[model samples]
Target chain A: MSTERGLFDLTCADFGLIRGITESWDHLLSRSIAAVREQFIEQCGLIAQAEALPRIAGRILGLMVFDGKDYSFSEIAEELQISRGSVSSSVSLLTAMGVIERTAKPGDRQDYFRLSEDPYTTFFARARNRAERAHKTIQETRDAVPKDKREIRSRLKEYETFYATLIKALDSGT
Target chain B: MSTERGLFDLTCADFGLIRGITESWDHLLSRSIAAVREQFIEQCGLIAQAEALPRIAGRILGLMVFDGKDYSFSEIAEELQISRGSVSSSVSLLTAMGVIERTAKPGDRQDYFRLSEDPYTTFFARARNRAERAHKTIQETRDAVPKDKREIRSRLKEYETFYATLIKALDSGT
Candidate 1:
């Protein structure tokens, strides 16, 4: 009976500690702002998944881009409620993609990350590259066709024109 | 021994029939054209998957777009070597998305599918709609932020402007 009482008391103390931590976090970041941030981050994650990228990478991007501030590596893991390992790999991926960049504060040894300058331009340039590749594929297909197949050649030409126009539009817009 | 011999003859006869069918198909559609069409269709399927659309639907679109002609439901299934049910469902999906359309010949009882007259325009319009949605999401997020958080609001406004510019570019190009 004494041991059972002691266990119950310990559970109560742990619950109180958890509540205290949550309350402090809520005080630092308002509940409304947290909710908004979560929604925005989820949306960006969905967008990234649609592009065949990792959802966590997109969420990391959302955090930095929406906050418009650099976050230390540990802070990112803690604030996003994700594993440090996940944060590390995703940061590397975003860095390699040129979507985000890493920096350091003068006295701080920990790495910091922020959205890259002109990420939208980089994204559009990637689109242009994909369009160019498609254009080249279509052109090669056209070349492989015999000269006698006029109908097929003409159709392939039309596809080439379409991709060329799309590339030009991306170029001008970017 | 006679039974084994009979099976061997049947196998040879089947092989000859298969070769003959292949030769006729090659005559009707040259081997080179077939190879090019397959590559183009596969590429379209990849693009469709990237956009979160059904890959088979994209292949159907590629066939019609590349050939610049309508295909009957049965023809679509046979040419793409997919099941009839898959073709039917994907056709419905593409029709709903306004990426492809169905038509009927004067004497034909079957459904024929073709690329919409302005499919690229439709595609761009869909992109603009997505941009608009992202913009709205950002705006709502911004509204939820407290007035004291000026920095977050400013960053969200920048995102809104980026999406707005994108929408405008898509509008003008389309």
Candidate 2:
């Protein structure tokens, strides 16, 4: 009788502590909201949108980040109303970008995906890098063309200089 | 012998007058390449790259100002290497943007386009108006969403703020 009572008492104490921990965790809870962001894990959806990922990727990011738990590929596809192929491609890109991570359940052959701690850092940096690379290629094109060809090359060089100048100016401010 | 002497006398007088004119107009002739004062007219290309129309529209202003010539739609499309459909759209947009104008050629069915002499003033004013219109729409979107769904609304607000801030910064820059 005493052991049964002790177990009951212990269970009740654990439940009470759980409630207290949640009640005192305003900062931690707000991380899931917009306030206490640790490198903006919460804004995964917004970051994904600016990255020009397909709608499938947006839902995948949203579910993985906001759904409070990791999800398997098939499960996410069903949730997002996308095909498994779409889910695979979206998650693959997100995983490669380090925005989403993959894990496997014990004894389960299939892997699951979840959001990373710093989604926006990858989002902005990768996007900037891609644009900068294209900018470089365009500059190369401008240079490879000969001079004095009816001023076409001159115009290309001028535009390339302008873009390089503008992006730098914007970067300096931001 | 008298006829030959008469021809020689006439040639000498013509040469003296030609030398006088050359000496007087030497400065202008020195500045003129090919010894001709060929005017570079800035014509807006009727057809433009659709994907690049907006950015190209701005560059067209620079192109006209720099090259001092009017470019036909086909010429612009060929130079830019974009489809005629795209150039068509861009020229239309630029016309609407009021940065360029269409000129009619007598007996020519196809219209020629050129940069407006007053480009900067109108483009700046129009861009400001566009920013104001965007701000109003953003404000409306914010108001339309429920306050409790702050996460979604706040992200959108941040995007709007970024664009608004960008416009302000650009407008302030020379």
Candidate 3:
């Protein structure tokens, strides 16, 4: 009976050891995931800055894209470690640009936000619109030039062509 | 003989009056040209700022595109009314981007510059390159995720698609 009891105790001990190891492994995996999330968010901010956008806006986008979940205004601020004011402004800007949309959750009074259904298309469309406006401006400038000045008129034509091509490319892509 | 001499003097006076009128008209026309050039350059600067590029760089491009003539470094500085140092840096940036090229004028040591051959294509190509790099980054981020994280992976895939479409459109247009 004594021998049997000892064997049982040893088995329990081994199980405890195994459980501890498994728990630690789970903890490490979660930590690694968190680290990757942080790094990815930072990278998004950097990329946005490279494109001359506000880094905070990019980070907000990163969180939405990576987590694949909606976040409340305060949640975004807390997750990004930014001020609520900045969050308000950035959220407004993103919404205005049609890159993100607001949502309502059951039993929640505050608004939540998520990436729009087709933000990429909206973004490209905006780019195309800007290019069209630029093309119009160039055309007007060209028209203002006297017809006798062939050289200047031709040069302006090149600018018009550049904007036209850009707009067409954006239109087709979107 | 006296009457004939008086008539000859009157004719000379009329010629002087007509020459003065022509000179003033030329002055006004040149001023209008200068104003249009200034407005165009300013527009270029604004457009550059919109794209997150330096205004001076855009102005330089505007000058080159509008004038359709090569300009010396000092001439660019003088014409734009910017500091020589600014012109130097902006010129370097433009050259590096392949939008402008330097040339040597015979019997003159100073370097002259003009728009690159097909600068529009080069500009679009650079944009496409940026989109490709962004797509690659998104792909790398997606790969880092474990296979089980299907949702995150799919979100990143959308980003990849956006860049791919943009690149393809740019390629087709250019």
Candidate 4:
């Protein structure tokens, strides 16, 4: 009977801790949101860098994707603590790439930016195009090389095959 | 008959152009390979930057992936035009991360480095681990917040769902 009472007290203490954490969750996140935001920025920065663009473009995309809401240029700049000019250029680049879309509010001249419905699909589509181009380049190089150079022929053929397979996989969406 | 002759002439011209290009393909790539190499380096550099690692590590991996062959430290330095020390440090980091592997020649003391057979698989595996960690963080944050704040609750829930779905996708390898 004493052991059962002790166990009940422990369970109640655990519940109290849970209740305290649940009540203050927002306060905790608000205090630590900077770290989370930085991590997302880094993730997007990587994607942007791989695509051979400025980090700012990735940061803007990351912000838009995470917020899951549209933001005007001024709003984005203010939220991200960046300059309006930087936001303008990055937003323009992302718009041209079709990674983000531009919309406007009724009776408002401000342009708002948001991520596309399926950004990953669009992202991989661009990658597939790049792979296709590289594959074509390798094929051309293979054709141009002398038939006698078997080693070079074999190496180029391998590259050609890799790119071909990459494009096929991307096209298949698997 | 005249139209047939004109078509034949056009085909012959095209073949002639192909022959010329074929003969010069090796020469062309040799000159342009630098640009191509830089592109790979840039791509890898982005990945490294996002991961908060040195750019050299990505450059080494990029070179190995593109070359599709094992290379000695000196050869890597020579090909990528980086310092020997940079190669040593970056190669170590990549090796530790399992992104690159170290091999050896039977009669040679020098260590050779090459990319893993399926680098993308391995790369995404690491990313999935990071995502799982982030998901846990988000879950904890959500648990700590008050339930009465609908806007904050919805936003946190959205982020939690995104990370949860991401981890699941990565786990399923689809």
The lDDT, on a scale of 0 to 1, for candidate 4 is 0.68
Query: Candidate 1 residues A16-77, lDDT tens each?
Result: 99899998776545666777788889988877776567899978988987788889999999
Predicted structure with the largest TM-score when compared to the true one: 3
Candidate 4's chain A scores what TM-score? 0.72
- lDDT value, residue B81 of candidate 2: 67
In model 4, state the lDDT of residue A142: 59
Chain A TM-score per candidate?
0.76, 0.58, 0.78, 0.72
- Candidate 3 residue lDDT tens string, A1-174: 354664346676788999999878764454466777888898888877766678988898889899989899899988999999999988988888888999999999988999998877876876687778778878877876788999899989988999898988888886
| Candidate 4 wrongly placed segments (more than 4 Å) | A1-55, A58-70, A114-116, A133-166, A172-174, B1-71, B78-81, B93-100, B105-108, B113-174
Query: If both were scored by lDDT, which would come out higher, candidate 1 or candidate 2?
Result: 1
- Residue-level lDDT tens digits of model 3 in B1-174: 354654346676788998899878765554477677788888988888777779999999999988889999999999999999999999999999888999989999998999998787777877787788788878877877788999999999998899899999998887
State residue B136's C-alpha deviation in candidate 4, in Å: 6.5
> Which residue pairs collide in model 4, if any?
A25-B144, A25-B145, A26-B145, A144-B22
lDDT of 1 by residue, B61-105 (tens): 888877878899999999999999999899998888787899988
- Measured with C-alpha atoms, the lDDT of residue A62 in candidate 1 is 86
Tens digit of per-residue lDDT, candidate 2, span B75-124: 77776666888778878877886767887778867767886654444533
Better of 1 and 4 by DockQ: 1
